[model samples]
Target chain A: MHNAHNAKSILHKISRAFLILIAFTATFTAMILSPMLSVNVNAYTEKKVYDYGDLLTDREESRIEEQLRKASENCGHDIIVYTVKSLGGNSVSEYSQRAADGINTDSDGSGILYLVSINDREYDIYAFGEMYERIMSDRELNRLADDLRSYLSEGDYYGAFSEFGKRVEKAALNNEDYSGNISVRLTLSFSTLIVSAFIALIIVFCMKQGMKTTRPEITAGNYVKNGSFKVTVSRDVYLYTSVSRVRIQSNNNGHRSGGGHHSGGRSSGGHHSGGHRSGGHSRGRF
Target chain B: MTTSFKCACCGADLRYSPGSGSLKCEYCGTEFEAEAVEAMAEAAESDAAGENINWQHANPQTMENDGSTCTYSCSSCGAQITGDRTLAASFCPYCGNTVVMSDRLEGMLRPDYIIPFKVEKDAAVAKFKEFCKGKPLLPSGFLSSGRIDSVEGLYVPYWLFDAGVKGRVRFRAERVHTRREGDYNVTRTQHFMLYREGVMDFEHVPVDGTSKLGAEVTEAVEPFDMHGAAPFAKAYLSGFLADRYDVPQETCRPRADERIRQSITSALANTCRGYTGVRPQQQFISVANGKIAYALLPMWLMTVNYNGKSYTFAMNGQTGKFVGELPISWAKFWGFFAGITAALTVILTLLMNYFG
Candidate 1:
């Protein structure tokens, strides 16, 4: 009986040891292999939606994420929509940049980020890498922000995100670089130059006229005798009336629709960890 | 015959002091009333005529000529002088003495009235400098004393006219009104035919009587105070040069008539107020009881030379009005043009980028 009890205790001890060892080995294996698997997942499928603020439902987030992925595929650039509960002592710009660094995993490091910070009540639009080069000017970025401002203001996050994806896809597909429209730029430049030339001509002409002081006298009003003018006959006869109408012109272009306190700044291109992010960002309360 | 005024206190030659109504001697500083001097000269002339002396022939210093140009001997220096027949008074080039060619001022060549110089030479020079002060394009050397070739006071001849002008003027006038309805603009206009007739009198309308002076420059210094004019007196011409009417009265009548026609048209147009696009259609005018009087008005004439070109300036001696054309610097003009164009272009470009 004594031998049997001792053996049973030994068996219990080895079993406990073996269980602890199994737990530790499993944890160690997970620690080592989880990162490798995660890297594989990140390489293959990048998450385009991060909804920490709970502003969007699971279905809506999924829908938007899929839409963004499709748009990214269409445009050959990564696109993301990230929402946060708070900025955690960092500016919306800094937080968005860090998030973009983690999210955009493409080899080319080309992506666009639409970030929302609920606690700060602010939003940011940042474009980097190849996207930055494609959207060349701040004016085009402002135009994009203007399009989304109304939707965001109305608390329509899904619509705003959806519309943003659609617009990015459409803009990329059209491939009409706003800054690269050389004809329009040249026309505007020539017009400004002509107006400036006209103004200069008028100034010089007036100065030239100032140099000429001689003028021929064409009236005898000075020599007219006072109280000597008389009127013998006066007559007036009316003839006819004419009327004309013209239509006033209206601008129908859908631009500059929403009102917001938008502020913009130059982003350091190729200076951040996201890899050659040479673009601008506009931030404002929606 | 030539006449020269002499001071009574000393036998020195005298000159009419501007704004003083008197002749002053530069040597003795003696002042004599212009009227009293004229009276004394007339008495001497009558006495000499009563003695059967032909002053034109007896005066050995006098020379007569019937051609376009006349030669006279200066009383001060006995220098022979030749000039245009219309040169009534001039300074002798040899001695700088004021000489009046008496033959030029006799009969129809004499002026009926004279407006003496109220502004002196120093005052006129100061005015010209002030006039040159604010002009930016004037050449830097144009105001220098060396560039001022001459400044001379001359009594320019003018013909003054008095007439009654009778005229009728017709005009096509329109009243326009515009209003906006919805998105369209409607403009309505009412047209009418208007007629006006009037008889007006004009007095002392002057026309330049010398072809030597441009009508444009002379008329620019016009509206001389006719009330200040005095009866023609040779004494007034002692210090300044003078000219007789080389342009006859008949030749100047058309100018006076044209001026009257413009005045009548303006007067009629002024009556048709509260209307736009008032255009004169037809006009008929007649001048009746037209009378002409010759007068000598005072002016200070200056000539400036810059870059081998001469520019003339004139000042109304009675009113101190000055006028002249200035030179332009093309370098400064183009520089200003470039600077303004660059600045405006940059500004417009920035605006378009922000708002386009």
Candidate 2:
């Protein structure tokens, strides 16, 4: 009976140790699996500039894709240029938000997508990921749009796309000198001068009016008997407050780390923010 | 201390001294208070009345007639001076001017009221410089102290009109309220109509009674103190050039009526306050029982010719309000514009560089 009891005890101890080893192995495997999964985070979408609407010729499209590929590799962030015949009845915001959710980045990082809708006559620029504010500020995006204004208006699609790629590359690099846009700088400088001159001219006109001291008295205020001024009629009526609301516009050019810095700042859980992460703003024709 | 303004000690011309507020001899500097002069004047009038004297209003023949009124001619300045025969001006009071007035007094009707010059010549000279002080383009030494001090005092003829005015006006007003809710802002306004009615009494509104002195130049010197007015006395014209009405009261009536209408309308508008927009929708001001009188108000006139164009400066005798035109310097104007533009450009460029 003693020999049988020792065998039972030894078997029980071996089973408990076996369960403990299994739990330890599973925890260790998960730690390694998490990092390995991060490696595939950006593998879902390698096509940086998708011409799904076939807006460009095959050769032009290939050339743009090559440039975007270089830009993406150099900037360490995805750069996308998309064109669509229709927005599938979605507003630009809604459509771009959906597209951003569907496309995941290589490193699960920040990215910018410029889209053109041929039928809707509308274009939108969206910045996605945790570093949306860092990727490009609203003012920078507006400036980028302005640079494309002439090309878009003239229907020079290839020129506009090429310029867009160059500007995005420059912005991603955070170039400090020349800003790659002398025309915009020159226009802003010249307008400032014109507006300042107009304001100065108005000041001079007011000064001239001051020199002209003689003015016809318009009110009887001076002549009214001191204690005699009476309103005689006072009535106020209530009117309904009609409300109108518009989406908030951002003009803050806040400090951003562009694209790569936010990876460490973000959570490792990596389920995507609310399943619709976006801090992008846009201006459109339609 | 005769009926006329004459030197009691040296037989020199005695004029009212503004600094001492007395009549002083120009030659001997003998001072006599205005009260003493008033007393002597009354005594002289009583003496004349006791003799049962009667004076006629007519042009004196040859100006040598020893009558109540006579004329003096300045061969140097060509000025025609008309005053009491006993008060023969020692020097042309309107003299020292290169430009002379030589017209003869055909039949001068005496003025009913005269405002003695309250501000002295020295004070007027200082005020004139104050007017030119801020004009950047004014030529240096153009209006020297000596030149401005020589400005001659003149009894300017004016038609004083008195009237009772009634004005009625209508105004549209608004009250505004603003409210904010969520991302929306709303402004609401209430409209109202207001009526104002008032009656005001305007004692003395003056119209220039001289053709030689244009209306614009004469009206520039305004608001003479009628309170200090003494009866028009020929003795008061000792050191000043006095004129009679060249333009009739009938001709100056319309101007007085227009001023009265404007004054009442403005006066009524003041009573309708606390409105968002108190605009005069309609105004009807009428002058009633208007009385017009001929009077002489004191003024100082100075004309300086520069670059073939003459600029006239008029100063109110009582208030010393100076009015004149400022000559613009093209060089200064263009320089100011360029300087401002360049400075603003530099600042803007620096700001853009720092901000960009």
Displacement of the residue A62 alpha carbon in candidate 1, Å: 34
lDDT for each residue of candidate 1 in A179-211, tens digit (9 for 90 to 100): 355456667767887898799779878877877
Worst 10 residues of 2 chain B by lDDT: B51-60
User: Number of the top candidate by TM-score?
Assistant: 1
Q: How big is the positional error of residue A54 in model 1, measured in Å on the Cα after superposition?
A: 32
TM values, all candidates: 0.53, 0.48
Worst window of 10 by summed lDDT in candidate 1 chain A: A35-44
- Kindly give the stretch of ten consecutive residues in candidate 2 chain A with the minimal lDDT sum: A234-243
Instruction: Kindly give the number of clashing pairs for every candidate.
Output: 0, 4
- The TM-score obtained by chain A of candidate 1 when compared with the true chain A: 0.51
Q: What is the lDDT of residue B70 in candidate 2?
A: 58
Task: Identify the runs in model 2 with alpha carbons over 4 angstroms from their true place.
Answer: A1-180, A195-286, B1-98, B101-103, B139-150, B172-193, B212-217, B351-356
DockQ of each: 0.25, 0.03
Query: Candidate 1, TM-score vs. the true structure?
Result: 0.53
How many backbone clashes are present in model 2?
Answer: 4
lDDT of each candidate versus the true structure: 0.68, 0.58
lDDT of 1 by residue, B127-181 (tens): 7777777766564545654533246677787888877778777777889999998
Instruction: State the DockQ, from 0 to 1, for candidate 1.
Output: 0.25
